[model samples]
Target chain A: MISLKRTMLFIPGNNPSMLMNSIVFGSDCVIFDLEDAVSEKQKDAARILVRNGLKTLDFENTEVFVRINDISTKYWKNDLEEVMKGKINSILLPKTESPKSVKEAEKYIEELEKKYNIEKQITIMPLLETALGIENAFQIAKSSERIEGLFLGAEDLTADLGAKRTKEGKEILYSRSRVVTAAKAAKILAIDTPFTDVDDDEGLVKDTIFAKEIGFDGKASISPRHVDIINKIFMPSKEEIIYAHKVIDAIEKAEEEGKGVVSLEGKMIDAPIVNRARKVLLVLNKSRGVM
Target chain B: MKIKNIAIVGSLESNDVMITIEPLENKLEIIIESIVYDQFNEEIKKAVQDVCDELEVKQAKIKVNDRGALECTIKARMEAAIIRGKGEIL
Candidate 1:
């Protein structure tokens, strides 16, 4: 239900200061990183910190998500257990290769929801990291109902392809296209990978616009610095919001006047079109300055 | 003393406590929006009492820019701000 076309910041799960400051950073969604972002020795400590942070902090409008280690690792089970016990909204499953992986993760999440007495279902964002993950993307997208979105881990995908990642991401274009196509086929949102170069806000903005144009709903960020630019590029402009309001008002007025259809900017509008207009307004109202 | 007097006023009326803390008129001054003020009354009260009790502080006035924060989140920010203010004073 969340579009999240804007920036999603990745906060190291173990860093208390970063996590504490995350809510203030203004990202549309905040991903508490527990995967390659942290070292093995500190995984448990990170989990504790993230759990305590989740327990202690108020993330408000910022959605809280966790990136868990792949099930291939020994730490995956414990990671899932700790994540379930906390107040996390979703779990980002890394290196997702097949639908079975999603189903497996969903079962664990279901168990956690029951164990914790949580009312809402904790959703999953399966990250396609490897070539196989990309190849089997369709299955992974269908693996579970808890899966509301799919993510790209471009660096890992590049590694899997035996190619180097560049600013243009040309080497991995095929895989990226495949991932997007699969996500579209599954009717899921395609979340783009983060730009490793933290200081290059221009690069981040370019890529964000590119991804959005290419059908990605959002782009992930390793550093918070990339957030503002990415957010600006993807956020529905103020003009768009005002236009949405105008369209909604006109449609309602026309309906009240017993008109069959209405036109906006020389385009026809119907019932379904009204719903679309409402969604834009809803997003604007929901995000406001936060976006 | 009740050991601590911590209070988180919604960004809207959060200043009520802050205005009362001022020495000349015994008040604190802070600005906040109205919507956050209305929705967060309970959490504000509980957070203030808890902060006052937990941190062993006396009197506080907090202002927040709530873009629809959760109850737990409001409490967390209150605790964090109180602790931060305490840390600064000490």
Candidate 2:
């Protein structure tokens, strides 16, 4: 199942109401945050809450990911102890600096799967937030087979770069490109960070367009209000879907005629164009829950 | 360990339950107030009972104000209140 990650909404682990209703918000993935969103005092409670939610709540059609504390923190092991006990789609590791960190996290995940007797494997989504992480993104993405995606944490990346955050997002351009390039090279999804300005719908659209232009698979969202916008922007448009169908049909006809080259709407189509159209159709099919 | 004073945990949110546990001398007393009490009252009581049974709690007064919380949440809150009432942290 190609998990469409058009919008990944974060729900605070301790917020029971939000956790229970996370699926109805229309986000493709709902991240139950046990890291930054939770305070030290409620860590245990939040873990328990999230585990219970995962065990009982039916998150129909929404992929569930749990963001555990970083490896540097003591809370991570305990977080895993609770998080691994439940059925989840993936684990998002924060502050992933090196490929070694990914490998270590995979090892821990394996141990937890054994301890909890969870038959299925849980994929990892390493968040590249630091300068070192950006530099080593490719290796980190390839470090573990369990890693299905890489997320660019712009907020923490900017902080690590010692640069002032801006709405223009020019400061982290190089880092974002590196993450996208790495994810592409490893054939994994590249998720962009959340746009902080929740009220600016136009700005969100513009930012999502920029991310899409730069080859991002999708973008994370903090508010449920942005889920529809993000999903709409990232998904293939109706015209594009029509074009994709034409492209595939043209290619199939060409193959039947023993032709090596194909033309669609008077423009020549090559391998790359055909592949891109196929991918668009695949994404479109996934968005409609056909795949 | 015996519970000391009254302790409350969890919330009154849409899918949460606020539970208060107080120490008692002899019998185990449980009072439940829920919007869906008639439909899920027995399940809610069983959840609290499971938690007490696990903790080996013999005597306590458990009050549950539920808002459609699941069985795991009810058990978690009951355990949290019981632990807090004992002046300890897990």
Most accurate candidate by TM-score: 2
The global C-alpha lDDT for each of the candidates, from Candidate 1 onward, is 0.71, 0.88
User: How good is the docking of model 2, by CAPRI class?
Assistant: medium
TM-score (second chain) of model 2: 0.95
* Candidate 2 deviant stretches above 4 angstroms: A238-240, A246-279, A286-291, B1-7, B35-40, B83-90
Tens digits of per-residue lDDT, candidate 1, A53-104, equal 6876778777889998898888877787866776787889998898888888
How do the residues A4-88 of candidate 2 rate in per-residue lDDT, one tens digit apiece? 7888999998887798788888888999999889888777778888987888888877889999999998888888888788879
lDDT of 2: 0.88
- Residue ranges of candidate 1 with Cα displaced over 4 Å: A237-239, A250-279, B1-90
lDDT score, residue A133, model 1?
92
